[model samples]
Target: MPALPSFATFYPLNHHHSQGACQCGSPILSQFHERMMADISRRQFIGGAAGVMAMFAGLRAPRVLSQQPSDHNRPILLKNLRLFDGSGGPLREGVAIRIEDGRIQALLANGADSGNAEVVDCGGRVVMPGLIDAHWHTTLAGISQFEAMTADPGYVHLVAAKEAERTLMRGVTSVRDVGGPSFALKRAIDQGIVNGPRVFPAGAMISQTSGHGDFRMRHEVPRSADSPLSEQEKQGVAVIADGEAEVLRRTREQLMLGASQIKLMAGGGVASTYDPLDSTQFTERELRAAVDAAEDWGTYVAVHVYTPRGIQRSLRAGVKSIEHGQLADKESVRMMAGEGAWWSLQPFLQDEDSNVYPDAERQESQRMVAEGTVRAYEMAQHFDVKTAWGTDILFSPRNTQNQLRHLAKLTRFYDSLTTLAMATGRNGELLAMSGLRSTYQGKLGIIEPDALADLLVVDGSPEQGLDFLNDPKANLRLIMKGGRVYKNTL
Candidate 1:
């Protein structure tokens, strides 16, 4: 007879088990088998055995690209680039940038050595920080107001996801979503389940009854504590809170849900049917309540106000950002500058499609707001008020797709470099005003040592002419966010 196979070879047991299991039918072998079986659950033992077999058979687990870590830890050296560091000055030529571990490690002069890193020749292309949108509505992107009010939430979210991807591909790596159901989307992007920009979600825009955030139809009654919340309020896109107490509670609720900041309708809006553009919405006490709540949570409040009185009241209540100050006068602009508040202005093109309102009064209100855009920009600049640029593309799928075009329109008021700086460096500074409540850390919107690696390598210099931004697909040669390359045509 052939020699009996050893227990180690037959069963592939460890040394201790092998010593006592030479004979299969022996008492020692039986006891060893029982003990080994007891040491591991049946399911685990089976799975482990199968895995070992698969390994021996040259089988491997399927790879999930999104779940896998990105090239964040890898070192990359971009050489021979015209670097626009977002410092509001001339671009540096023949510079090299080294990125490692999701941060800019160094900026080198011409012919400087970068050892053992993956080198990319930029071919004298323009390198700048990824753009930032100070104000955006992520969940409302690509959806008309009517569609948003009538469409299913699932369908709306799908559309928002597609738009988010489009926004990122256009070189906008970060956005401050002032209103919408952005918390879930932000998590999805951060977890690598989706590809999009880093979102600073404001949770919901807190408004007074019939204010800008109230999307209720005419038949719908004013919201009360006893009444069921509207779909928009329930989804955390907007909340209608009436007195000071309600305002404080709603603001706190938003903060509880991870709102980076608070948004309040301090004045009437052009799109809202019940309020005139000049009508003040929230009372001073109510506005102060929201501001207090946000401040307690280490954040600040941004208010939608176009009129001088509305802007002045919000400023007195400690609102840090004043959005849509189109109807503001020079005195109001000076007051905003004195208060050190940011004027988040949108350049509404006169020839663009106007916002549709069922009420004739609301349509007139829209036109009035549109007519004040130029004056708003000029006044803000004249007063030396800190200003941030945003598209404010709400309720129009067509307009949402033209985000970069809207940014380019700022060139009418500023030079190309100044316009670019507003969208990148200046806007980034304003976004960080949330302080401890900010979602992202590390400096952004600039290509400097220790800043987050959100960069764009454009085919042409935007500082020379912002026309390159109009066609991002062809002009944006490379896009990298957090050291992960999203687009690389080169």
Candidate 2:
């Protein structure tokens, strides 16, 4: 009977031995190719099954509701509900959850446990992980004020308290505070003295003297018909370090200050007043020095880069990730991928109201910084680059909410669930956090036997249609972060 399992009969063997090599076990082209072939096959099948015609809006609602049961969370049990497990897959229905001590004890089929409990009854709402904003600016005062407070601990901590409120209320549970605003805020959040997102902070940015983060400007003041960095121009945020020795020292300094990671201005910026976006500000030695320090400190360095030369420099220097990447040419994009450095994309969508600030005032030299950002996003997508969402919020009034809404835009048509995974399981992975995998201390993003009870309940089934997330302030019925209900319309 077992004449021997054929090679084709074993899916794993076939995928590995015949298909191709991929870091992820799946065949590199399998998904794209499979979808293409399926589309063709469906077209042929549709012609034969001709009676199937179009339906009106909300056609999927009946299917969704039929599976939902009222009074589901009897003892905090999520009633009949749809589930997105955050593993880059489609949604499931009729799932029930049991939560206690802020930990998710179990995830099972609808009515899996009818035992007596104080269930909230999901009523079949959509449940997924709490959001994570990696590139949040916790210390926001305004672009005009950041430089002045670089050494002012009091001002930095004060700003942190205010932004913390803005971040958590909008559903961002965890944040990676990269560059500026200091690490004290992250520490305070961990200590519970402040109420805000869980922070993974990079104390202050490290940069070359003339680089984009460098706040220094040339002395030739007045008006410049041709020159950009006039002598009278203000200093950039980048710390001016001339040689490799100074760069190395600075990197260590950043680590000693409690940097979970490092942010280096490897190139110029589109927004910095001191340097142009295309300028190759840091040399390889300077960058390598920082990388060396980061390696020694057991952390990664995120480089703010926008030029081909600068990209190459950071890549060779072993910067762990590329931020912005707006001006990166084809070769640079390839180079970033080749090095396996992650791309932290900031999807900051600016309306005319946001970009009204003129050059040298609210300050960025370009007519608008939005163009380069959008272009970078397109290229990053084209190359299939592994990306994480970043806010780069700065001191904007919308605060961190702008970034959360931007994620809704990325999957406007379909698969918005992937964005949630990028914000959670994947983000934790990027930071080399293993035990916390798929968990908010065992409750939030992932479904497991023992996980936290931090869950979100939205109005519609996300898989059927994603417009539900389009309105963050609209139609959300329940939100439980760390088993504490901040919002519940149920």
Candidate 3:
């Protein structure tokens, strides 16, 4: 074969130089370049480029929880419990649940024989489904903004790991991770490398430039056309995309990365600085691009929006879930009911558990959201809109310890039973909107035959009040997820 062509001859010097092609100014350098190029054939170079492209395109196999053989085959019997069932129904007593293969095999009648299984006596405690937080930020809930923006990605992930275990110990066994770089944490939990809840991940919060998901500093604005993606975007914390084409591309990227659902920033947010509370972000066409991309992947889109205009735009774009609609008006609430969309509301009561913002404007915005939250709930109830509950705790490690308290705040709006059901079954139903994109395959948020075995055995009745949840270490006598006992005090 003819000698391999010189780098400058095969490609223009400027183009090759910019791409890190060999620059041989001396005879020795030229010989070294020739030897290196001869060792790596054109086929090898093309194959290497294809592998890099594949990595960037996210074409790797999805990381799902590999079933542990021991857990998969072992049968477990949980006896002597009052079943809350998570169906908004009265608790049923004297039932024992049979669990196998990470699911409830059967609900045995009183005194039924349990053969060859480990029996756990719950001592007449109230057994309920593990909690589901529909709008959680798994990786961001426990870290400060300064740390998240400036810390190493590995350190942030370690913080998230500790927080995940805390969340699980608090009796929240499943969470719909609305934003953040949680894929690694989620994989760790699934593989039993870390103890945590089931994660329904939306890889990143997709936003238009200057939108709610945009976390760039003011000085970082006026981004050059050819500038690289920001650090946060590269880390999967958030992505800033513009226009229909860019939105479509960004949404697909998340889907390719194993996002169970897509999260779009369609309106202003208190956590973000530049966007006003009343301002809408993505246009209907741009929102539709994301929706269409998610829909094609057998999943749905949930939008971060609050104002009526933003809510309406998202709904028209086929968004299935509306997150943070605390400022929604009556017409918007009615539209949500008409469209049968999910209202993923948080109890933004401006209480001790609320997110802390340094500036007065954001504080005022928080107060406004809190003021509208009660009315928003009332309207949702009146219109019979489907509602799911979450505690969007952010940026405070201390506030994360109050997860149960934030959940109990829902009792101020509804009775304890309704509140419990909202956090359990209702939120699970909302998570099911992910369809085929869901990572876990069994049922969640209910104590029924064949439901996934995520359970909490409480010492007292939650029907009267959720105060017991405020003390998980004491009152939550037993906690089980995927048929494996994580905590047992009974």
Highest lDDT, which number? 3
Q: Write the residue-wise lDDT of candidate 3 on 1-490 in tens digits.
A: 3343322111100000000000001122122223333434453465654422332232122322222223446798889888998888899987899988789999998589989877778888898999998877776567765565455433545676778888998899999888755776677688887789999988767888877666665566689889877654654656888999999999998888789999888887664456777889898999999999999999999988889999999999899999878889999999999999999888877766665556797678778888888899899999999999887766567778878877787888889999999999988898888888998987899888889999988987888998887887788877889988877777
lDDT tens per residue, model 2, 234-316: 11112445579977876676566556777777775544455555677678888888888778766777877756788888889
Please report, in order, the local distance difference test score of every candidate based on alpha carbons: 0.72, 0.55, 0.75
Q: How many steric clashes between backbone atoms does each model show?
A: 0, 33, 0
RMSD, candidate 2, Å: 21.6
RMSD for each of the candidates:
18.2, 21.6, 11.5
**If scored against the real structure, what TM-score would every candidate get?**
0.83, 0.70, 0.84
Best by TM-score: 3
Better of 2 and 3 by lDDT: 3
- The alpha-carbon deviation from the true structure for residue 193 of candidate 1, after best TM-score superposition, in angstroms, is 0.8
Give the lDDT ranking, best first: 3, 1, 2
Against the correct fold, how does model 2 do in TM-score? 0.70
